[model samples]
Target chain A: MLDYKLLDALVAVIETGGFERAGSELGLSQSAVSQRIKLLEARLGQPVLVRSPVLQATPAGQRLLNHAQQVQLLERSLSRTIPALNADRTRLRIALNADSLATWWADAIGEFCREEGLLLDLVIEDQDIGLRRMRDGDVAACLCSSDTPVAGARCVRLGQMTYRALARPDYLRQHFPEGLTPAAFRDAPAIVFGPHDQLQHRFLAQQGYHGRFPFHLCPSSEGFVRLALAGMGYGMIPDHQSLGEVKAGRLADLAPGEGIAVDLYWHYWRHGGDFMERLTTTLTRKAQGCLTV
Target chain B: MLDYKLLDALVAVIETGGFERAGSELGLSQSAVSQRIKLLEARLGQPVLVRSPVLQATPAGQRLLNHAQQVQLLERSLSRTIPALNADRTRLRIALNADSLATWWADAIGEFCREEGLLLDLVIEDQDIGLRRMRDGDVAACLCSSDTPVAGARCVRLGQMTYRALARPDYLRQHFPEGLTPAAFRDAPAIVFGPHDQLQHRFLAQQGYHGRFPFHLCPSSEGFVRLALAGMGYGMIPDHQSLGEVKAGRLADLAPGEGIAVDLYWHYWRHGGDFMERLTTTLTRKAQGCLTV
Candidate 1:
């Protein structure tokens, strides 16, 4: 049988990009690292590393690297979670889009935790960036808008979130009689969430308009909705998030037929604590109820 | 921090159902089991067991039991898979349903393995029962019909499979002109895969017919389709599975509008080797191409 210490040594060398650096980091003699690699190759009956002036990982080494990283992550998770498993303390951490957080995800997580008797830590961020945080081990799970999962992570489609261009009814009435055209959109002010928030920009671009908006940046989803409700500017909002406002005539649809649809996905590390599993289940069920498909 | 030994001790006791039996099995004294359980309870701040005369698991203990079994399975898997990670041995084990094996899964797995320079070990069985084998640490993964994943297993919905009630054209012609009325099906002979196969039963029940069939039992999906093709009896067959026969006029639809729809779910233990991930990705892609939904 190959020694686990040898596997660790090989992984360390691969990760650090050289044997000498790995040895220094692991506090082992350089000869010991070499011997471990040689013995590992002997046990596996094949060479794993491609030794050169600049270290390079062979296909086999790359495969091992993937598994080693997963194992390391699992170990860290086990260390943090096992203590709580034995104790009455059960805390779940989940990353979600601010829109979803303000819309339905909190109620879903709260209801599930209440029934399951769990403590929850909710991390809210933009869906585009939340998935990266999930992959980096910052959060146990996330609800994001991408089907392509990060390497070493798992993903499932929660459902589709449809966005409609909206503004306050008074703003729409003041801005147009024949309805706003592509030419008029350039001069109009818009409320955007952040710099990377290109939903309204994309909707405008699709209509052959390339124009900058006088900006009112509200980073929070609730804040943006409130700003729009107060007749601030035109913006894009998810149907579920803006439905109540639209129904009450506080926010009026700008172009109802031209909506942007982005499907949401639940992404998480392949291996983690039960908190990840519970959160994924709750989010998936809630998304099924809220989204279109 | 939890001592990993405590989890092992709890699992042994649960598996054996007694302190003495678990102690003997783990090569420890009964007092050791008692002491470990006491320590575990103290560390967790709650009792994991309910013991008067008989040993029983509390809800918290049951949760730990699930995690314990997963840890044990993963430990074994790590022992087998970690060493092979950097080995020249190009072998992979894949578990899948017999129907898909006979149809498209085998070719996909074979092509992927060949392209990736891997030797394949295919395990084919009924989709329903095969997942248990995966949970028992026998196989790496499985293609099953469960949407709710097994504890400690990951699941993905491939798509929905639509099965048409199929029969030999001659058999249908001889059986009825009313075209699969409730009366005709009450005494009709049907081909079923084996015991516990309920596709036909459920389809008939939906049409308000409570009747038993003179069943010709064919266990394998290929064999069931063969039996139906040989004019033994009518059976429900997936459109992909029976497409060739249906196109050749060997089989005819008995109730096209009242077909059965079964959504297939792919499941694998969270700690299986890389083969599980590769197989899941390939199977999900292939199923999307083959299934209706």
Candidate 2:
């Protein structure tokens, strides 16, 4: 069996990308980190670390690293929740899409946790990426935009998130005199969350219009929605997220008929712990009221 | 994040039902098991095992037990396969139903492992139970009767396993002079695998026949089939399993038109390594030839 301390030290080293830096971060001597690696290699009867100026993990090292990370996360959750848990108290770690996190999802989680006397650890990421974090054991549960559950996780359809192309009323009026067509979109300035975001790009690509735009890549989901509301550029936003802005006439639907419907799923580890089960039940109930489809 | 060792020790204790028994099973001294349990309880700040000569896990303990068992199995797979793995080698662990194991499943696994240069571990149980094992991380993949994949596992249709109500020809002839009827089956002796075995019961239930029988409960899948072949009582046997006996005139289909078609699914861990992927691909190919709709 691998030594827990050595595995921890190895992961720290890998994460830091250097033995000295990792040692400093972990409050250990640099030589201690190096020795731990050597001991781990000896136990496995194979070289685990490639000792360049920068530390690089070997395949064996990567395997151990992955397992170690899972173990580490599980350990953290146990320490936080198990120790504090009484019949009256619970703790939950949840991953959610930023749009949902900013919309009704957080309110639901907050209300449920408060009523149940539970602690909530919220992770905000894109819906597509949030499920992967749940799979990797980073969170106990997730709200995602996928009906198909990742293997090993139990998934229940929360409902659908309807996304409408939205922009400031003035921008749409100026850009759509001849109606929003594929040709006009090619030269239109756009606002996106980041380089990895493909929502707007996908909408364009679906219409056989592959175009590049000068983009204001706002990193924050809330900020991006705000920028779109302020007439920066056209962007796709979930109806729930843009509802207030749209109702207040700060933003208008770019193309009412050309909306995307993403089915939302609530996925969790199937271990049936109280925290996870409660969260699943609460989310399922709240989704009935929150989702449009 | 619960301590992996604590979880493992807790599960072992729960499985064995006592510290002494668990210690003996795990090759540890009773005192060591006790100390480990104490430390685990201390770390979690809660008592996991309720001790009174025999041990029982608390609800929280049971939750941890399930997670621990799953993580332990995954760790075992990682330990066994990670060292031997190369770009050219694959390691697969499959949880399979006992009926399938006795029929054509093992041969498929064997041939696939041989061809792919994969090391394979087989966890055998009933179809209903096999999927639970897959979910618990006992195996990387499984063949189950469920169309729905266990939470977190990928599911694909393997094919349909068809079963015909069968009996020794002489026994069937004697019992069904006026054709097999629900009234006659109510008093007839039946061959079933065990208390959990439901195939025969399901067949009878589907026919709206609520009947009690003097059962020859053979626990082993192979043994039950053999007992059926030896004229112990009527039983439902897979068509593939009874083919040879039927051809040899030893067994006959009691209700040829009233057969049950069980859809078998291949489910695997979503985060499974290369071995699981290769094994699933190979088994799917082999099942296409073996299973009849």
What are the runs in model 2 whose C-alpha is more than 4 Å off?
A1-293, B1-34, B45-95, B111-142, B194-198, B201-218, B273-275
Q: What local distance difference test score does each model get?
A: 0.65, 0.65
Predicted structure 1, TM vs. truth = 0.37
lDDT by residue (B1-293, candidate 1, tens digit) is 55878876886675455677678657889899889999999999999888742466676886676555445445444645676544332323345654564454533443454344343334555665566566555455567677777788898988877788898898798666677676677555676654446687687777676543344444456546655665656888888778888899989988767788887777777665455566578867866666766
Model 1 spans > 4 angstroms off: A1-85, A273-275, B1-293
Model 2 iRMS (Å) reads 32.0
Question: Which digits, one per residue and each the tens of the lDDT, describe model 1 over residues A114-191?
Answer: 444343335556665576566555556677787888887889998887888898777787665557675467445576
Cα distance off (Å), candidate 2, residue A99: 59
Q: Taking the true A–B contacts (Cα pairs closer than 8 Å), what share appears in each candidate?
A: 0.00, 0.00
* Top-TM-score structure, candidate number: 2
lDDT per residue for candidate 2 within A94-158, as digits (tens), equals: 66665665455644554554344343435556665677666666566787776778778898888
